[model samples]
Target: MSKKNRKFLATTVTAAAVAAVLAPSVSADELKFTDVSDTYADAVNFLVGNGITKGVEDTKFGTHQNITRVDAAVLVARALGFDENGKYKDAGFTDVPDRAKWAVNALVQNNVVDGLSTTKFGSYDNLTRGQTAKLLANAAKLPVNDGVTKTKFTDVNENFAKYVDALVREGVTKGKEETKFGANDAVKRGELALFLDRAKEHFGFFDLFVMHTNDTHAKADMGPKRATAVKELRSEHKNNLLVDAGDVFSGTLYFNEFQGAADLQMMNYMGYDAMTFGNHEFDLGSSEEGHKALASFVKNAKFPMLSANLDFSKDELFIGLQNNRYTSDYSNGIYDGIVVDVNGEEVGIFGLTTEETPTISSTGEVQFANYVEKAKEAVAAFEARGVDKIIALTHLGYNDSLNFDNDLELAKKVEGIDIIVGGHTHSELKDPVVSNEFDAPTIIVQAGTQSKYLGTLNAVFNEDGVVTSFGGELVKVGDFEADAKAEEILAPYKKKVDELMNQSTGVSTEVALDGGRDSNNEGNSSVRHNETNLGNLITDGMLATAKTINDKTTIAMQNGGGIRASIDEGDITVGEVMTVLPFGNALAIMELKGSEIKAALEHSVSADLRDDKTGLKESGAFLHVSGLKFEYDSSKPAGERVTKVEVSEGDKFVALDDAKTYFVATNTFTAAGGDGYDMFGKAYADGRVSEPGNVDYQMFIDYLNVLDKVAPAVEGRIVDVNPAAAKTVAE
Candidate 1:
């Protein structure tokens, strides 16, 4: 065969025996076109990549363009990669143009198709959908229905019935309407691609391996162990994707000292394929520098980050980094979704942060769209690009905040997602939890937080891109020995952290800082449901810090959940401070009406579940206040429990005016409505919240320095009016 004859289509195609690593498009070229609507993306990509034309232009498919009879023969003959049995010097038709003679003759000699007539090839006549289907059926040698002459489609005639049924049997065309085949309509360039692509046969099961992690936080010290696991997993599977779901941000002294720089370096060393934003990724957004650390992390990343529901357009720092398209040809940066090529098969991955980020963390101007809406859009986008096997890399938590959003809810709501790698709730799913029980399975997996485990999913997708079998497990990072290079990369960062961990902040204390919790649910603190000296000290520091930011700032409150651990009655070390306020919460000041304050104070004491021992309700939301006092009836209901509230002036306390507006300071968590503080949530939504970025621990340390001796006592600022509740506390 001459070079042009061989160019009829592509070289010999082989059936692929892939384990998650499927065959590539013939000639290994990336399909480049966008005008073709997503409705035809899969079929267009299939034939254009492997069978049909290489697009009308370099970047255009011109799907709406017309194709003549001779033109269709030329394409189908080439696309079929027909084996020529006839050495036709001419097609023996007078009207057949020399340019189309060889292709028409090739199809005729093979008995695959013929001209409209022997005298004329109808070179300029357009091909209809039925005619195209018959030609494709013959080219693919689809079995003719034996003696059967009817089709399920209403408009399909007896002549085209068998051909249309054959196409449908192969999952090719589903007709224009379910019951109607638009058999006589002109076959567009796109339809031609789809029919031909879907008509081709595929056999055998394909295997895929996905390695994922979520909520790893800044435990860079575990990098060596995780690196070992990652290397081992990738080495075992030729086709694999290594991804982190999110929260590679705050947790330890590493994040506190180096921000995200250290974690990014470790992630790069481990060769992360992709990552997504966690609510904590936006923790630095309220800082004075305004998401600078997070932005820098994205820019320096070796892999792309994804978030379909996140809109970084309003945040100038992330403007150019975000490519608002789902595509198979991806690059390093951020995108709504990406189709990664793994061992020849394409896998689509998108991301979603919890919509509560603005309330749960300091998310500044970066915005979040609805997850379900963006998720559907992502699935459609990937499908258009001919990619199945979609993975939703999410930080929405596992079955968390059900009233809002979570992985379980996401799995139930969205349809096409094959797997969900999630975090936020830090659930350790030992086995794969399957959703869409009645439909296609969506396997959900989450590794426990702080780099403790590496989640691995080995799944097999059948010909039609359906998961036939899957197994998943969380591989403990501690089980593996450290990788030499990982340790080498980690040494300097660990050394820096070690140097700071034990260092005294020069804040002397005569009494221990009581970051204490009552016995009920051991970590549940009295500082939560009532005032503690530690809460007072922290609140005093926050109030002081707020005053520095704004002189009018008077009241400061700290949530008990934000306080993690206690300090001893000795010299204060950097480590203890971090342990207590490890989340790196900044100061967020919001203006609230006195009515709203009373409502919030009500929520603070409204815990209905009382501790068996203390007879006090266990609540993480208990407020530790400075420059404020409140009395609440614990026996009363949630929204109406606060009896009286007062604000402190310089020398005297004044009853809180219900309509007066006041500036109150707290950690970013509460300011953003972290712990069911609806008033603050409303305040944040109303644009009354301002994050001054005062590091809470730093403020506490500064206050400790000013006090010369740290012996803070609870001063009865918050009192429960219930007599029995008071007696239980005394007991």
Candidate 2:
């Protein structure tokens, strides 16, 4: 009844085959229709498989048998869900040769059939094409144009003209030939099966099958598993789409060496229908080439990448390859959105990225518009195209902060979106979540990170273009075997990666670097809660790197979660440093007030828990400092935890002044509020941050080269007054 729901429900009818495709498939082998050829067998299988008809015999379907008027009534009744329970007078039934008496009665009771005379039901005569049209039109309750005396069909008389016009208007048939109806000709059994099937789609039922993934951050090794799953699932659904939400770049050595080429190959081979650009997709936008790698990835992708709110026109690398509006005719290019026709259903798809892209990633000149405004415009454009079922492939986090642009807020603000396949936060939505934000429901789904799972969603939409029934699940990639063809394609890339990981970085350590999770012989994760020598060494490297670009940058920090693995006391390989900082996070230098620094350090251990079994539980937010020393009282409350904070002035440590402003360096992830560092994000948004575009591992490697032999120690920079959660003085 609402304007949004009515835009897509008007003026269109699909063939009855839409019904068969939506329901479970029935093999042609199950039916004994030997006379039906492979080309025409689908319709016959649909009829017999759905209990709408039985063959003339057990081994044969009598494919070409003449369908009498009474037989037409029987088939139409079954297709309309009318059981033969109606009792009738001599008006239209009870005299049609017991085989079709009840069938004729049901049709007559429904006002879909009429007798030639009071005592006659036209039982023995072969049904005419014109009569078939009238029966189908009446049975399916199609709107008849009573004044339509003239139609495309020249042979149709005034009596059958309205009924034939109704069928044509609903897209039931084009006539026997395009211009001729052959109104008086006898209908064959096969022909009737096709007609009835075509008429069934007018009942206003639609089904959509979706296969989606998100936050697959360069986990290229799982390409084979994904390929196998995508291929199998694509074949299983008739009306389907294969889509990804975003974040397909960064995270592993595959991206480090290949620069999204390897991931693009796998995506193209696996057949992605559409994709959206995640923020990390533009990670190299600040490099010398300025988005050259991202441009190549876009140029080579076999599928269209949708981006409704982002603009790349200013960048020469994306010239002629990107468009600014929504379209129905989509190919391999970037557009605001695209219209996909799935089994005669018009599904409008668009993409939305977080507005925080500029502050977060190395987006360079590529501008990001407000997500909510663009999303509304996209839905309006889709509505103008008469497409009701809309899908938004998004990189906006699923449940990010309400103040930020997230999928929940988008769904709540937008009026007509039916499905939202999202990413960015990397949430593994085991089940679909619905937002009843408007008159219609919007179903949101996200596949977990690293290509570990594939999301499958099956939904049933009503004539109003609203989802009435839905189900979704995450399929574990590890459960399936690797596809052979994909493995063959991946072999060369894997070899190159193995060789790169094994290549030495020309730097060695005297003792173990102690990047391990546990610092003491206790359960506390050393890298996260208690500082280690490796943390100190890594931060020292960041500070050294940042100062080379901006001498004002005096302090450097690293999030505990960013340090993944430790190194042994030996020659460090390129792979060893890469393993430690696998995210490919770039260096970000931010100018912050000393008070803001204290707030950030406090939030670092705000959630630290001391469990009886795990000893002290620290979150990934714990910070490893480089040019400063901070002390916290773990026994005190969170906001009041930090006891004292000071900055190192060459050889002397001076107490940090509350009003002083200082420059600090950290990874791009943390500078953008990653791991709950909102203070850094606030500063970055205020334009106090500068990204030198130096990759984190490359900086570490550079620092390692300068040091030659690493021997760094945690010299009481971060201390805890409460001895219970503190590491021993020697440690």
Candidate 3:
């Protein structure tokens, strides 16, 4: 057979396998077959008992006879749950006899078999070993051979090479010998029976299928679609696990209005097994109201909220929320790890949140330990309990610029973890990153943010609990139809959010206010790197709000990382504004010397300026200024990157006087020195900052209300002295 022909046949058999849905088991003792080898007698009896075959006679079995094409089809069809008595129309093969028509028609209708020609069934033609391997491999729906390129058997044609390898990988069949499959050799009755039996056992083996998502950020629209995909995948595979890598809060109007209720409801509907806390999960933890929101989200979550490194012992809000505490023994709840039985095998799972949560979000009284150290303890704990396969549910990000403990680093430093489902960087990895730096294979995967994609990883583990073969793919949630149940659950929350979303903010923009993180020269809208129109609009709001109290507040700055989304050109609604600035941060004003401002700028660009060969670095701390301008070079050293700084004075740009104190406006997150801005943190601690009691998004709304039409563009507020070098850094 040609490669094209083999692919066509494989597709046919795979479809048949999916439709068949074979039953649990069949008793081999019920079958009595004569003239069978002792090694193959049980296998032949298994096939006979399943109605896949019958002896040549009641007392005699044709174990030595060459299996025919029709014989092979009947066995495969029966193994795949085809009933001979079913109402199947006669296949259009003219040469097929009526006695064998049922089996041929069933296989043909399911695309498992094609006629030898357009009209001839070729029912009597002897089935070859290569052909038998192809049929059995396809019927089992075994993963396609990835590493096997050349044929293991010299006699096997390239067309049948992959099929043979797949069969070998599944332990269904080895070649007739070590290096010779005897491609054209006819399969005897006993040998065919053994192949079918092994194939059935291969299907019975427990393979783990994990469907995961992360960083949904309250995109409730993705809930129903993601539920649909998870449902379909769970139905298709056994021993399946569904998980979330956290960051389900703080992005759109849904989170702002419902306070993660809608997102949690959706997750509950999807039946998540486990979840970890992302930094955004702690975004609403400053007051009782914020703590209540988090408490409510945790109360409603049906699954365990895992975090091994967090010391929630000192926190009252999370008094009873700890799933499992770190100790020699493990229970369930918010613990270091938990072991769940997956098809009779205990799968140990643990969770890890980034250690930088306290500095980035309002993680009050929740001290965090080193992720790597905690991970080691979790692995050891699981292994002590005889659990060999361990999975790490983490929010450490894929690779972050802040030199934080990321997933890739975790995989390298840790020894026992088998898989790491991660989030926080919002990276869309089409392929799972396989790292073999430790004792076992560590597969790392993260679906992109906002519920746009659903990641599925199927892994086959050996008896020792080590992964031997793996396959993964990201299922696009947008491509799937929304589940009615998920949508119904979200209806009430949607109505409330819809009301707030439709409220017009009384501002229209001629161009989109871009807040994306991509490095494009068109608008430089990625607030993480350079000045953006949206950033300017936001800081202008802060400056205007601050000026109400102190007229001397000349400079306004906002962290690029704090700006979430962009607004397209047209009528802007309150919902769009909320989506762009969903953290619910309040406006703050602070007094800082010109020299202090320059030092802050230097700290802001330090991550990007420090070249560890990662190219252009992005820091959420990268300041977007309204009344100040500065230029930096990527080729310069980290602390000395900012060469020139100036502030706007009476419609004219003047050099910043290091000795002069100026009032500056920014969000409380920045004023408190979130994103590693230590200077701002120290200044705020010294009573140089004052709270204006204004919500950040409300400030933007008030600022926009004064303008009939708003169109802010990126100007020379932020200049890269070496533009070419900066582009390299961005790349």
What TM-score would each prediction reach against the true structure?
0.53, 0.64, 0.55
lDDT of 1 by residue, 40-132 (tens): 664554454334466777667777887777777877765655433536645577777877787788877778776677778778878888888
lDDT score for residue 428 of model 1: 76
Which residue runs of candidate 2 sit more than 4 Å off their true CA positions? Answer: 1-203, 401-404, 506-511, 517-529, 539-565, 578-623, 626-628, 632-709, 720-731
lDDT of 3 by residue, 1-731 (tens): 00111111111112233233211111232234447666765566555533467678754568888989887887787777667788886778887766678878887787666787988988889999978777777777777675565676899877778888888887777777888988899998888888876676353424688999988878887798889999999997777999899888876678877889899889888888888888878877786665678777777788777888987777777787775543323432476677887768888888998875665567887889999999988888877777777899999877543345788789878888878999976667887766655434577899977788999887655445665445577899999998999999999988887898888777789998888876553433367877788888899888987887678999999998888888889889998888888766756677899888999988777775434442246778888998989988756778888889999999999999999999999877687678887888787656576544356786788799897679898887887777675665477
Which of the predicted structures, 2 or 3, would earn the higher lDDT when compared with the native? Answer: 2
Ranking by TM-score: 2, 3, 1
lDDT of 3: 0.76
TM-score of 1: 0.53
lDDT of 2 by residue, 1-731 (tens): 23443322110112231222112212343334578886556556556634578778866777788998988788887767565665654343445877777778777877988888777787888999999889889888999988899788899999999999988887667787878999999999888887875665554546688999987878899999999998888887777899989888876778888999999999999988999998788777777887998899889999999999988988888899998888877688899999998888899999988776676568887888889999989999988888888999999876554445788778888888889999976667887776654656677899877788999987656666776546678999888899999999999999998998899988898878876776453554478787889899989999998887678787999998899888899899988898888777767788899999999999887865575422236678989999998998877777898999999787988999879989999987898788989998788556576654466887888798988468887788888777765444435
Query: Among these predicted structures, which one has the highest lDDT?
Result: 2
What is the overall TM-score of model 3 with all chains considered together? 0.55
The per-candidate count of clashes, in order, stands at 3, 2, 8
What CA root-mean-square deviation does each model show from the true structure? 17.0, 12.8, 18.0
